[model samples]
Target: VHIIICFYSIVLLYPQKNMPQQSEAIVIYTGWERHALVGSDIRLSCSFFSWRWTSDDVTFSWSYRADGARDSIYVFHYTGGAPYVANKGPFRDRLEFVGNPGRRDGSILLKNLDYGDNGTFTCDAKNPPDIVGHASSVRLLVFEKVPIQAGVITGAIIGAVLGLLVLVVVIYYLMRFLVARRVFNLSVRSVSLCLGLRSKLQLILYGLAVTRCFFLI
Candidate 1:
């Protein structure tokens, strides 16, 4: 009885050794917001990672919810190497599956978007035992004309500032060079003038000495 009790305790303590472990899937998306222009097409990017091996059995489902809508409707579905797009909704003919299940991509393209298409998009993926995970979502913003991104504007500003600084530095160096050359020329002219004056003084002194010697003789 004691031996049996000890065996049961060991089994209970090492239960993981008797049972295999399963990992859950992880869904990825391009953040919580995406911007698009009206009457233009946009690709909703999505991918997933699964601990299990990839196969055709991997499935994907895309859904959408309007700005204020409480319920979301299916937009696209894929399984068994085939796709089933929405056939009777606002996205009926505008949704296209552009992803490959073999590569774990669940991206979709929405064409000819309208203002009403501004909403949230969700992507869900399943790979057999890795079917349990949170779906990824991205909110879409439809605009008449998409505004320039802050990053682009900031980059342009920084580039302009850097260019201005470079121009200023170049101009400063040029001015210094010009001034240095002028000062060096002035110094050379002063040295030449001093030497000329010394030579004239020497000639005057020699003439005086020669006149004195002739008188003494």
Candidate 2:
């Protein structure tokens, strides 16, 4: 009787001990914003991190809210190694699944973008026991021509400055070499003139000595 009572007491005290604990929440990552020209293609990148092991149960979802739209709408869904793209949305035939769930990526490629496609895109992911986290969002801007990025502009300016500096250095070195060559030529000419004058003076002195010897004889 005492054994039965003790077993019942233990069961009552720790009834949830054998239950599996929930894992850490999933963390979704995405780029802040992207720019693409109209009629071009772009990749909306997304990935996730989860404490639980990745499995076939991992799923991805994409939603979109057009500029100034009040509500967002689902555009793409991925589960069980298959994708279900919306058939009658702004991204109807333009969305492609470019991510691998096993690798924790949920990115999608947007093709033939239009100005109407400028909007915010949200990426949500779920990995079984790690399904509790906020989704990541990225903004897309479609333009007639993609604006130059600040980094690109800075790099161009830096390259131009470097090229100018290199040209200046080359010119400076070339001028120095020309000046040095001219100075060498002038020194050679001066040395040649001095040797000519010395030879002429020696001949004149020898002729004078011969004249003096003739006079003495």
lDDT of 2 by residue, 41-72 (tens): 99999999887789788999999999999999
Candidate 2 Cα errors over 4 Å, as ranges? 1-18
For candidate 2, the per-residue lDDT at 116 reads 96
Residue-level lDDT of model 1, residues 38-137, one tens digit each, is 9999988888877667866888898899999999999899988899998878999998889877888888999999999989999888887677888999
lDDT against the true structure, per candidate, is 0.88, 0.93
Q: Candidate 1's error at 150, in angstroms?
A: 1.2
Task: Give the TM-scores of the predictions, in the order they appear.
Answer: 0.83, 0.83
What would you estimate as the lDDT of candidate 1? 0.88
Alpha-carbon shift of residue 52 in model 1 (angstroms): 1.4
lDDT of residue 202 for candidate 2: 100
